[model samples]
Target chain A: MTLTTQQSKEAEIGKKANHLVLVVTNDTIDKVYPPMILATTGAASGMDVDIYFTFWGLKLLDKKGQTQTKIASVGNPALPMPNIMGMLPGMTAMATKMMKGKIKKYWPTIPEMMQQAKDMGVRFHACSPTMGLMGMTDKDLIPLTDSICGASTFLDWATDPNSVTIFT
Target chain B: MLGTSLATTDAKPAMVLDTKGLLCPAPVVKTSQAVKQIQVGDVLQVLATDPGSKPDLTSWSRMTGNELLSVTEDGGSPKVYTFLIRRMK
Candidate 1:
């Protein structure tokens, strides 16, 4: 009834073999959700999950970026209000607040989600070029970040034939 | 396969974790927590209401190197998902 050592070992190898690579290029509240959800779920499922943050996405890792992140209600058809209505100056804040309210019920706030992602073993990688472009240093970001990496380095991780990759 | 009934199953599970209404990582997280309570090779039964629980638990089982012996819907108007997972490690 018991599995042989080799059989169990094979199962162990399968369990550890999966990986998910997520690339985040936007820092908006909507933009961050996909990778956050993916990373947390992927890592939770026993797969290795590494997220590469580049350009605007790097801002989300900054200590105060999430607080200032806005939702893209304008030009978004999913919104109840029209694009013209979304053009109002306060529309972004309103939309962001509305999103926060809706998401708070089921999902954690941005900061909490970020913490949870880290707790789930989701590795955060800050793109090196974006770090310089944003004029930000390691000290500017949260401690959750594993390291600053270049495109080539991130590509190497995504290039793994066995791993699933996503860009958001 | 789970509808076969646990009584006729090869081995009984150490615990049953009901994750109805819970979504996303909740089911997986709870399963991980419950899995620790059982010994190696012991099974854990999870009853969930979330549709996502299917893929979630499936991948979780695979990711943890566990054996997913069965997955089936319970009899009723709205089907519930039941997963029989054996802790391989």
Candidate 2:
């Protein structure tokens, strides 16, 4: 076959392969939602989805952290309030509550979304080195945790030629 | 916009999903779940109030290889979108 035909054939194959890898590196509620949303929706769309949680994002793998994640009012340009207002004692809590209220009105809670993702076969990867850094054990992680792995293993999973990898 | 297929426009749906008051990804996710309960070649009708569902469901139906048979819009206090999707696989 000609080079042009071969390239077109390869593109056709790529279009048919459905795999998604999301690398999550932040723990703030705003950051957490993107990867979780993508993972759940991607899996629902019949794609194989893998979410790798590292650094601050690893906190979400634990039940306490999931329950306690706060929305970042300070240094958030998207927030309509002044930065100094965010520094006030109750602002963060208020912001978190307000956002969660809006989110819950339209979509399922974070825990519910996680449960749906798990039910749909989306894999969750906990960063092993970060686990050691945080001094967390497997038992401390949520039941949704599929594996504790390093960067290299997660990278290997992202190396599929037909897969799409995202960082949030 | 992807126009309704002439042949399937009047197709009877096997199930109906109500996603009123829900937004964004929820409608698409629920529709995906509803689609699984039916046999291939069966149609699933989805009713949603979120304006975003128009484009979202279109893209979803295309990505999943499910045929979007028809889309109807009704003007109201909260606009309603009705989608008829057929499971192709």
State which candidate has the highest TM-score. 2
TM-score of chain A of 2: 0.88
Per-residue error (Å), model 1, residue A45: 2.4
RMSD vs true structure, all candidates: 4.4, 5.0
Question: What lDDT tens digits, residue by residue, belong to model 2 across residues A104-165?
Answer: 77677777878888998999889999999989999999988999999789878788776889
Candidate 2 lDDT over B29-83, as tens digits, reads: 8898999999887889999998889998987876776777789999787988999
lDDT by residue for model 1 over B36-85, one digit each (tens)? 88987678999988788898787676566677778889776556998888
Error of 2 at A114 (Å): 0.7
Clashes of 2: 0
Top-DockQ candidate index: 2
User: Which runs in model 2 stand beyond 4 Å of their true positions?
Assistant: A1-17, B1-6
TM-score of each: 0.82, 0.89
Candidate 1, residues A1-168: lDDT per residue as tens digits? 234743665666664548899999998887888788878777666678899989999887888685677788777888888889998888888998998888877677777878888887889999999889889988998888998999788878877877878899
